[model samples]
Target: MFKEMKLLKPSWITALLVIVLSLLSIQNYRVLPAKEDIIFAAIHWHGPVLLTQTLLLCLIAWQVVSFRKIRFLVAIRGKDEVIQKNLLKLMTMEVIGYFILFDGSYLLTGHPIFSKGPVIIGILMLVLRMVLVWFLGLLLITTYTAPYPGLILLGVLVVNLFYHYVIEMNFLLIQYSQTYDPLWKAFNLNR
Candidate 1:
């Protein structure tokens, strides 16, 4: 089972995750606050958030990279065919997981960011992503080469950044009134 898994080298995977985790930790933090609550805030919450996002990103990235490894081009590539089929199956599971995550998080948190409407939208988007995988996988099958895998990877990274910093931050601000928030109530989303 371990050999059949075809995992990437542990070091390479760690390095990739570190890059993303570091970027996530650094973006849109200091400037977002007025006076630096840097010490207490970083000490209290940053580490946990960083760890959680790192793990989540790592899991998502693993799915992506693993799927890309399946070579789609060879007419007789049993390996590619099997891997692609497995990826499709895994993606279905992932979609269901996302829906559950969205629903559960929204219900428990009572945060606008995780509200039922957004959760439903997020679930729909997950389904859309799976559809994209099917179409993209078909393209790769016909071409036998993922000519622009980097493009898709970069796109996903950007989307993650927007979700984490922009969307999540807005939702969080609306839910919690904090001294750490910026001076302009106009800029703040607190309701």
Candidate 2:
């Protein structure tokens, strides 16, 4: 079973996976109700949250598939510890990036789905966005030799940046720039 797997093989399939996942995220975002204010935007956090979670799940699947390939390679090519270590590190970073994305989205959207409190949500989200970007960087580096993978990573970066700057940041800025009295009164946050 492992013998059939190949590292950097089926590059188009991986690229397609990335595209499908991103489109799902964008679809979730697009479905939200339009509102002037971020706090009262009538947006349900579940869609985006679930979508992001799905992306993470896909990444895990990729990791497993890649591991199978690595195992096959190890068996035939004399067990390169460095490749294994690097793969593990990349997977770890991807997991960490997912957590950051979740926390950040939660905070930026004003805890729409879960009420985990506001203290660390923003900070975590900022870190998560950075981590997500970093994930793309790693993807680009790892898949640079493969045209499809590199192109897919580039596409993901473009989409992510578009969403962050055009949509997410707009809402965040609105949330931050407004007077606190109305927001505090609306959300019942004592401050």
What are the per-residue Cα lDDT tens digits for candidate 2 across 17-53?
A: 5545544544443344443232222122434433553
Estimate the TM-score of every prediction: 0.38, 0.40
Worst 10 residues of 1 by lDDT: 35-44
Look at candidate 2 and tell me the lDDT of residue 44: 25
lDDT of each: 0.43, 0.46
Error of 1 at 185 (Å): 3.0
* lDDT by residue (tens digit), candidate 1, 1-191: 32534542234554454445444544434343443332223222444234534354345445556544334442355566665565555444443443344334333432333222244544444344335434443333322245665565555546645544564455443333343256555466666
> For candidate 2, which ten residues in a row score worst on lDDT?
35-44
Off by over 4 Å in 2: 1-5, 35-44, 65-76, 85-127, 130-191
